[model samples]
Target: MAETTGGVIDAAERDLIIRSQAGDRAAFGKLVEQHMKRAYFAALGFLGSHDDALDISQEAFARAFDSRAKLDPGRPFYPWVYQIMRRLVFNISRDRKARGAKLEAATGWIVDDLSARALREGPAARLERSELEERLHGAIAGLADQEKEVLVLKEFEDLKYREIAELLEIPIGTVMSRLYSARKSLAKRLEGVV
Candidate 1:
């Protein structure tokens, strides 16, 4: 069977893409519903604010839909969407640099329930854990942009070294080195706190 332009072209998403390309607003809406959360989360992780995430996510889908005909039929869709998102983040970072704005903390360290439980043995322990999360986030914010990007992609997004290299257009070795440095720096910073 022939594949469609939306990549791997599952029945539902393929139908939606086809309808969307043909100017079906409802189909496009459905497409947004399917992908928006993932897109928003990716953007939030990169850009670090709800407002910026909203703008970046909306821009990415709009750009994707506008250029729908160029999308490959055999690849996964999220990678393409993520590329758009990364471009938006780079642009945002550039603008912030031009305006002399410092990189801000994207969010608190995302401790899962198990990690939280392990850290929080009592009320005082929980408070101490929260303070550590804040300090860790501050340390992350202090990292170089490339280092921070590498860490977030590898740890939070669970991207492989090669995947991160491709996403950031760096060599795999560079990704590994940056991740190593980031982890070492974070560990040193969080040593006594956590």
Candidate 2:
């Protein structure tokens, strides 16, 4: 079966993983270029801050380069890299939680960029949509790490259950369970927001 990824990079991932495993820096750069946006957004979905997301994602790439020997030449590269990323984000989240909540989340991070033009068409509709979005953001941010990860992969990253399971190294049933729990949490959090 063909590998699926966020973009055209899937076809090149195996060759790039092989080359990078042999210490080809240029090959790794191509891999980075291909996957950076996906990595950044993945981190953003976890960390919920643009600066933290960018930093953590870039650091994950650097660390992946350092540990390139462990990368399997026959496997898709992204899932391996995502392990590093998820760990980093989890650590950072733990640290932040220990330090207590601050002003980390803001409206700028979860914006729907296209909402502006839509807003011009209907003021009441815009207000309702904005409120719902705010509530949704709050709900997502409050989710436990595993639940949040599953939800983001399914809803934002648009990964299939099998793909999420493969990437996270969990069973497909576990992916469905996590997704179901995450959705239930979001629904409870959203409550009656309209």
Candidate 3:
């Protein structure tokens, strides 16, 4: 019953949402299984540490379940759960900034998928790739959180502008504007290297 542009989740998902809203833990578990990885990665893109992402994603689900009564059956579940996760991410990020703690660069979160290709390269090529990744990560880390969030949703999550707008509860124009700013900033940061 979660209304969507195409169709409120398909029958199975809608059924799970209904059951979850009815206090069915197993149904909620199923929903978690469907979304856990994407949720974790989204948090990873924000927090930059595997452990923190894992903890925040799990905690978000816990909060979501605790507030199950507020879940609208006519809405997609991930976005609701995402709002919880995003708040947790922003809170921790703000705390870290206040404490002057820099985010640690986790080895695998962002660049692991390229490992096979990297392995085939010579040491010099691999080193160059590693350096580029480091610079890119540093540049992304320097972005304002709002710009970073929009960039992550569009680039890493591969969500379309409309989807990103819906997820962030912003207008499509805002999503485009933020994305443009993020990309422009990155381009300037990476101008010489790339």
Candidate 4:
């Protein structure tokens, strides 16, 4: 694997990129298969709508394919695809806000299998965890879009500070700052609950 500005690019993925750039649908499908879930979740983190995320993620891939000739096989693929998806997520989010539509809280995004754990910890513990997750999701949803974006990318997507910076095209310090602000806001929101 070779490290590029985007990230690590394995040989197979690089070949897929090359073939994809040559207008090979199967190669492009392979690329999409690698990234589609992450793309949808990334959009969901921003828009908080499953339907919107699905649509925007797919649309991003379509647009990416349309501009396939511009793809650089040397770099990792997801970052480039993420750039496309991010724009669509933001545009739709802004439009919804402008029209006074409430962005749904991504309450369902976090999933923990509590059935077995519940047997061990009891129903009360499960209920508490479920409630905590709800509160956390609500607090996260209430964050400013920038703060939310940084938080989701870091905490949920599990991207490193450098990776988040590269993905968002921002400085690492900015990413850290936004994450700090997000944490503080979440703390304030969950002060009593937690």
Candidate 5:
């Protein structure tokens, strides 16, 4: 029963990936449907704009499809897609800066539904939650590029420390230390806010 369940889950995931690789539009659509919101949120968290997030998400999938044969079926798809999105965002940021353009944060951008849902509960509760999220975002933005990358991959992407170390091509101990420092710095910044 245990093997059967695992096999069924693996089969389903592989089928989707295979069909997508085979140029089945519906299958590709299903893959996108499964991952879109998560990818969008990740992009938004990094790029800080709905428009840029949408563009990055779309471009990532396009690039993935174009290079589908390069993907290893044994690896999880989300992380691969996220890496593409991260690269695209970085490129966009670099290009904008090269053109003497400044990136602006979208004003009144709520990170997610939790803040709005909390608002419906009560004003005092909502205010506190919003302040915390704002502080957290600010702290994350302030982190060095490598530190922020490690933190986001470990925390938001739910990657294991070893997986992050592998992805970042750093040692496992380095991943742990970076995450610890990232959290510590965030906590210190948040303490002043709250």
Candidate 6:
């Protein structure tokens, strides 16, 4: 999905945005319906926790609604809401006193893809997979937030370089470079498993 850069808009979404900005309840609901899931998953990938993702995403939406007048109809709604979500996540993650506790609370959002062999090969294989999954999660969690943000947006969200750059307000080359550095770091950490 291409985002509206420089406040460009398509007609249908433009109508929704206008109505939403005008305090139309149903129109705002429509906007929420369209973007909530994306916002949740984006928060999940950024914060590395299910509960924080749900709470923060909802709060971001609420804040967006409260600040509806500031919304530019010519811009895409999701990206606008996304900015709010990202800022909340960043602030929480950067808080020295709360960061460790938050990280501890953030497990289980990242699930390992259990293979069919987990059932067939029984306990040992299952244990190994579990260990590797935990290790990989830790490795990923250990990355600097910027690298992790780039990795999550590109790999987990499946965003294109341009899209990631646009969302991050950076050049496309910077997005690719960050992703490359993130992958290299993750690979080094996971070398034992793969």
At residue 138, candidate 1 shows an lDDT of 67
Tens-place lDDT per residue, model 3, 1-194, is: 33332224667777888998898999999989988998999998988899999999999999999998898777788888898999999999999899988778534568654445666897877887777777788888878888999998888888889888888888999999998999899988888777
TM, every model: 0.73, 0.87, 0.89, 0.84, 0.69, 0.88
Q: Candidate 2, residues 1-194: lDDT per residue as tens digits?
A: 22643222344677888888888999999888878998999999877899999999999999999999987666677777889999999998888778887437655677674467558869887777788778877788888889999988987799898778878988899999988999899899999973
Residue 112 lDDT (model 4): 55
Give the Å error, residue 55, model 5.
Answer: 1.0
Cα lDDT tens digits, model 4, 65-108, are 99989988878888898888877877886787788776564566
For 69-133, candidate 1 gives per-residue lDDT tens digits of: 77654454666777887788888877886887754544442455634784659878777767776
Candidate 3 vs candidate 5: which has greater lDDT? 3
- 1-194 per-residue lDDT for model 5 (tens digits): 11111112255656777888888878878778778897887776666678888989999999988888887655556667777877887787667657855335633444567687887989888887777777766677666556667777776767788767655557899999988888888788888665
Q: Order of candidates by lDDT, top first?
A: 3, 4, 2, 6, 1, 5
Best-fitting candidate, measured by lDDT?
3
Task: Report the candidate with higher lDDT, 1 versus 3.
Answer: 3
**Candidate achieving higher lDDT, 1 or 4:** 4
Taking every candidate in turn, the Cα RMSD to the unseen true structure, in Å, is: 4.2, 3.1, 2.5, 2.7, 5.0, 2.4
The residue ranges of model 1 lying beyond 4 angstroms of the native Cα positions read 1-15, 98-120, 162-171
Off by over 4 Å in 4: 1-8, 113-130
Kindly report the root-mean-square deviation of model 4 from the true structure over all alpha carbons: 2.7
Give the TM-score (vs. native) of candidate 6. 0.88
CA RMSD (A), model 6:
2.4
Better of 4 and 6 by lDDT: 4
